[model samples]
Target: MTQRTNVVVIGGGQAGLAAGYHLRRLGIEHVILDAQAAPGGAWQHTWDSLRLFSPAQYSSLPGRLMPSQEGELYPDAAHVVGYLADYEKRYELPVQRGVRVSAVHRDGAQLRVEGDADDWRARAVVSSTGTWTRPFIPAVSGRREFTGRQLHTVQYQAPAEFTGQRVVVVGGGNSGAHIAADLAHAGVDLTWVTQRPPRYLADDIDGRALFDVATARRRALEAGHTDTGGVASLGDIVAIPPVRAARDAGLLRAKPMFTRLTTTGVEWADGTRADVDAVIWCTGFRPALAPFASLRLRATWGHIATAGTRALDEPRLHLLGYGDWTGPAPATLIGVGRRPARETARQIRELLA
Candidate 1:
């Protein structure tokens, strides 16, 4: 049986939930299809110690503020999971769990979202599958041959297994820095590697500041000004408490990326080498656009080309939470709710009318 909705949201994470909120308020019937078995989305898979860059009050959805975790200045991953679960229930969003969408294609004037156990045809489709599942590791020489254990951010949990072991953490982003700090705090022999020198945001800066900077940058670009690089100009890594402490203690110091992986460990361009027991690749991810493969809508940067949130190639589709390409700070919790969701829903309503 084909399930029909006015709008079909192809992910039930933060982005999809936010879209559902606005679509409901606009009286547009919609269903959110989620691949995860339960709530929390990507937060369910994050390391146990992972902390938000800002306080709970600053990291909220459209209608509700995330409740502060007792005794926590910046909430942990578990707290985020709880918040997402509660948010879904509070909003009564129509989310169907464990529905892994395989493809989205045109069917007459409507778009069809085909999933493992169900099908949804709708006048509009919002694809919000964020990048957690599609992690990227650079193609360094001998990576496959490295005798040491290797894992990506998705596979990592607590730092128990790596304690006291020689570990190399790759990538300069927040994930890389956080994981490196976790390992270092555990007394591991840790080497942090990045393509360039790791840039740290000021101690006073947080997610709220980053969001403001990003908003300014977007507005400037829209007004025909040169790109100012926004939050990037400040730094790549946010100085969260643990990361800050680790950096102050010299535990989070980063080295230049190694030239290649070796059988035992890694070798640098110079005669330098390190024998590490494990290499954790915090290398980041590509947008999870595989389900939209039928549409061939991705641009050169691997995201759908869009005007605001609507796809250029397929006007029936809107993309949310992928990144700035979708909207300013669209990938963040506050950003997803503030801009993309509301705008996308309004556009859908206009189109249907």
Candidate 2:
């Protein structure tokens, strides 16, 4: 007989973990399915030198604080993974590792999740898989002909591996800035390519990291507002600290978007060509929704479209950790995942009743 769960969370990242924790608190029967062998979704693939620019106070989950001092700069990728592992252990979350969910579909009043091991039936599905599952690599001409190594920033782990090599870090996002700075410090020839100029901000405003921007946005979303016309964008979020530091160290320079990949290196949109040993595409990621294509997806720019935590049309399917889901605040850091998980758990409880 197929195993059945009251709710099935699609990803085991911070958001999914939070959802599971809340569900357990509510005494709800649920199971978390993750594609990875362990937790910490994107952090597991981040560069070794990365540290959360946001402070530790803003990085905690619902009931637990991220083990650190109040004003300490946020922990690095390894620290994040360790914290997630601890969260899982403390709550005894029932997560099935390596059970890659291939598809999710409605079966009468139940939802069917087909995985490598077996199928699962649940009353509700929380897609906490996030928007970063598939790295978005813009199509460039002659990419296949590139002689040098090329990899997405998601695949990058440490700058020590790229020492003494000329590296072109593509895209203008946080990952590009962070990776470029780390590699430059490690003595790699680094060039940052961006079609548009990047925005920057200070790490602290009046002695506090601008974490209130996120918190404020979360509150706004909970109140039923959708557009973030007045809030700062993600570019504005990562501009502080490390990005500013990268610019100060002369490690970052804005270049045109990559147009073509040549045998020697890359050609920019401005017709400038650079010969580099490797290319790090930090262009960001897309929501991996191939598994649930049959479901009506309210997508904007390839991300799931939702009004607050509820999907546009499919109310039973909720997308947690989506950028701008709860306005400006919930889109960044591990801290924002809590609000959505709590809201989603409440919604699930109401639906199940």
The residue-level lDDT of candidate 1 at 290 comes to: 90
Q: What is the C-alpha local distance difference test score of candidate 1?
A: 0.91
For model 1, the superposed segments whose C-alpha errors exceed 4 Å read: none
- Per-residue lDDT of model 1, residues 112-210, tens digit only: 889887788999999889999899988999999999899999999988988778989999999999999998888889899999999999999999999
Give me candidate 1's TM-score against the actual structure: 0.98
| Clash pairs, model 1 backbone | none
- Model 2's alpha-carbon lDDT is 0.76
TM-score of each: 0.98, 0.89
